[model samples]
Target: MTIALEHPVLHSTAIALPARFQASYTTRLVAVGVDKRPSDFWLETAGTPQAGDVVIARVTAINNHKRVETPESRKAILFEGVLVMLAYGHRYAADQFLAHVPEDLGPCHLVAAGGIAGTVTALHDRVDEPTEIEPLGLLTNARGTVNVRDFAAFDNPLKVEAPNKRAQVIAVLGTSMNSGKSTTLACLVNGLAAAGQKVAAGKITGTGAGNDRMIYHDAGAHSVIDFTDFGYPTTFKLNFAEIRALSVNMINVLADSGADTVIVEIADGIYQGETSRLLRDQVFQEAVDHVVFSAVDALGAKAGVQELQAAGLHVAAASGVMTASPLATAEAAAVLEVPVVPTFDLTNPEIVTAVLTDHA
Candidate 1:
């Protein structure tokens, strides 16, 4: 069940591998972009591993992430000794593990169910230890090491421009992770589509996962994409310039999809490293026409709106977990100048469209 590859040194020619490989969800978009599977692999014992380098590793233990999301989005249960195809990447999750790609192809953890392999540097108090894996080799082809960047959809450099003339860009920002950003965005997409508006969406940041992309598609988005489409397994330690360029490219690509409106979500919270810089950057502020802020509570909603306003970005409305509680919604509405739109109201075409139109 193991594939044999000749090692350049010591004349070694074999390594144990699973007979059937379980491709991770992060590889889904890459597969589509590359149009073919990797035909070869080699154990790079000496070279440093880079973000997005595809690795085939054997699961050494199961812990927090007991399952790996497959390319098909199925949560496939993992067992010790099973081989998983994942990409090396850095991760920044406030409620989970903080991880980075290893310097060498040694043992690491499956930091994300989305198929990211990295060494955990820190973990949230509530989060269990990450699943462990021993990398077997880097997946490769005729060109060399197979990195997600090799199959990126937006490989070309993009020049930042005004928001597309044909599309109105509405960006959704959150107070923090799990603040209902994706839900708000999906609801907005549904509402817009219900009103007969062609809607396209993208998640320009965050770890590579299929959940948000799937939600967008199910919510009636005519076109959907995320960081994964651009070859990033996660946008954890990316710089402001890199993130800004990504934003421009994502917006441009979504706009070109013929949608009249584009709704993009910025992953993580406003205070996160890249998110904070992006909010303050003139380029990002000018790229989007309006912004919807999502937060978990009234205080967060108020403070988030104020921060967005201070950043020279238009605050269209506020929504998120706080809307689920009538008292919380009332409290937010009492102090905030922006409308506190509930998830239900967000789905109402008239209400959602009015929010956008009023901000427009």
Candidate 2:
């Protein structure tokens, strides 16, 4: 049992207690359910509550009719945690317990699951959302190229292998997290697919909810996969081999699915952590194809190139913040001995060829 918090992982809090009624489960029950909320049977377990037990719990309160400046009508859920309404996803009516969630990057308002207690359970399926890693069925047809429920993530509307053509694999590497790695991949996929290339995309890092894949699909990628695609509640405590093997397996799977170009999105910076970082090891360095360096500015971009190339790898293209100005892109590329691609929307399709063509 592991929980993802504070960017780094803390195994200490990931308790795997066999919750028994009035035993180990007592503390959790007292901490979870309270107030006028309906007492649920399916949400609560009689004996020790396990990880996947659906508990109809309320959040501790904030103030009533709380005012949020963001205008994304939200209320602090008692007990569960916080629920945030992302700009995307199923629009909930007021009846939805976690209704007032926002459309931005904030904490969840209600962190617990709601439903009749003792609804149903199998050997595996259970509760979710930042806690248990139970794979549940999607109530609605997933709207995007990827489907993430609990810890299980998979490509939505699976792609069939056509014409006996092998899937083209393209792995995107960034200097760090939130550095436009996915944004650049989205652009690349658009360019490649528009040029008649069948694109399959996925992310390798164990962070970020769905920001990376949203554009990857909107930009024209066919199928997308990420760590969430696998049954991982979060990427915490995983070893380097786990990350590498997961990346390799996802690419291989996408390749088997017959993608002309399987775009792999690497989460976090190349140098972020031992478990998620790929650039720190020599073996991992030799396994990758092209490295798409994403940084904040010209100087940061230049620094990333030197650090990566010094590890004996080629810096394929530079992207991210400097995409607005070709001059900033050109300066970083010159310093790193690679071409610069700064467009966020796949404006130039030829850029993919410059980085991937064997003619270098």
Candidate 3:
């Protein structure tokens, strides 16, 4: 079967195959090969693709499998691998044909499905291991030069085991939205990971925006996750009791992530009532190993720690404030009698050690 030049086979969104393939393209293709693991292609592709995207490839003739059936009347094609959706669903937005690899890499095929393909940029053997990042990406709806799409939590409920069990769990809480919760989580994750601790980071509560967890991942955490990944548009629907349960459950999941340390984020502030009330819940207050509070002012920071301690909750360390306000950090540390490490001074070993050791 001859292939046309116009039909570019996309190896990835970034890389298209070289030119059109020879006449044997179709004969060498298979919709889903038996030998290649269905899950491999998926795990390799997550975190890179998104939903409503196109993927083109020539079919190998070895297997005549029924394509994921989509009635002609249907608006779009749907691919199925028993574990594909559940496996990579939350990592990246993916909508395309599914296939196994460790097979032949014949000529690429056609547009296949989804919206139009973007320009091909890369095509290398996929990686199965995770990588570290800095300045975790925040999910945002508003437009900008850097941000691409508005991030919203999956519109449903989800449950998974936390990433690690023995890992130290430290959650970063903030006084209000945009108060640097994400930024602080990143720094803490990086510091912990650099200290030889395997860290899995997450944002368990918030408006359910996306960028914050991205920040955690970028910060050097071995694995990063969020409430959005847990399938919630925001934490508003979650009562304090729910968050308490979630915190306990999520901490366990992160612990299972095989990391020596875990960073959890509570969006908004300790005084936000919802956030504060949630953390102080017996389940969370008991399970959490540490708490990093982000404050807008010294008084708020002081009060938040005092209240959490008064309620018998753990206070890990204080980091992140709007400006260069030593007074605020100092006052917070003085009142709480804990280290008040600032983001600007995140690199200090003494402070970091104090945080890692003292918090736990």
Candidate 4:
């Protein structure tokens, strides 16, 4: 079987294992015990193991976002090499995994860029099928078991206290993943920084990945962070309490980092599992001074605004792919009764300043 020896997750953690070992399927275990902590799994050459178990696997194919994170924060080719990834048991908006692991060594899909191991159940028409890989074996230790959580970085509660007074929080919420939340945040950061304001950016939810944070940094954010900084491979189906605490701590960190303004990106649609629940939380709502809504289309824009309004949150303005089309922006602006700012205007400090000033 092919072997993948390069993955950023391994270098980020202290978990060490033999160069190689036997491979098997335990996706069902991860699915059933979704609530279990990552460190609680048994990574052995022989034992009853569950999902979230770290395993060394070899890439048999490549597709979208065909590069993996390297230890130096650079992207590396993911063709035919050994890598460590989390055994993901949950469904995604794009693809999903089989309920049980395959009985024998075979091909499976990389369901997420964060290195979630699973079989693809479906695909969006725009993208090709997922990259395929073969689980070579569990990277065993002297005790003969390997676990992904062992090498996981930031696998502990954030030690920050909620700020007594938070800097103005400009939160970016979207209609769906890839609907332009990160881009909007980047534009906001770039513009605010250009205007001589200290901007701290954060991704409060979603799978662990450094791409969004990198974008924010490049856009001139004074500092950037994500849920991965708190030890989660992906935030899918995470408990409400932990997720809420994470949001609070994230804001606190940015606020305390000497930021005058903080732009936090909330992943997925406003109605998405974590996003929806978070919007409804008093603590979460109280931390935000302004809400920037993003959507792919006019209908989505209207619906997003209505969702937030229903949750007693006021939207500052609308922006995203829908704003890319003048007709769609006009329609959404009429429906939302709010300005529909295009991506370009998002980088205009005056435009953002007016939006905040008008709302303030």
How many residue pairs clash in each candidate at the backbone level? 0, 39, 42, 14
Q: What is the alpha-carbon lDDT of model 4 when measured against the actual structure? A: 0.67
What's the C-alpha lDDT at position 41 in model 1? Answer: 41
lDDT of 1 at 147: 91
**Top-TM-score candidate index:** 1
Point out the worst 10-residue segment of candidate 1 by lDDT: 1-10
- Tens digits of per-residue lDDT, candidate 2, 57-166, equal 22224322121111111222222232211111211211121222223212223221211111111212222322211111111112211112321434322232121225
Off by over 4 Å in 3: 1-165, 239-241, 331-334, 348-350
* lDDT accuracy of residue 333 in candidate 1: 95
The candidate 4 region of ten consecutive residues with least summed lDDT is 22-31
The CA lDDT at 139 in model 4 is 41
Indicate the residue-level lDDT of 12 in model 3: 51
Q: For candidate 1, lDDT tens digit of each residue in 21-44?
A: 678888765555333332344444
Lowest-lDDT window of 10 residues in candidate 3?
Answer: 81-90
TM-score of 2: 0.57
Please state the error at residue 107 of candidate 1 in Å: 0.9
TM-score of each: 0.93, 0.57, 0.53, 0.78
Tens digits of per-residue lDDT for model 3, 1-360 = 222222233345223222322211111111112113222121112123332111233232211122221111122222221100100011111122222111112222121111111212222234221111111111111121111112222222233323333766777786666566778878777776666678898777653233555577777878776654443333543555556656666677677778777778876556655676776566566566777777777777777777777878677766776435867666666766767788755555456667768556
Q: Quote the positional error of residue 183 for candidate 1 in Å.
A: 0.5
Residue 242 miss distance in model 1 (angstroms): 1.5
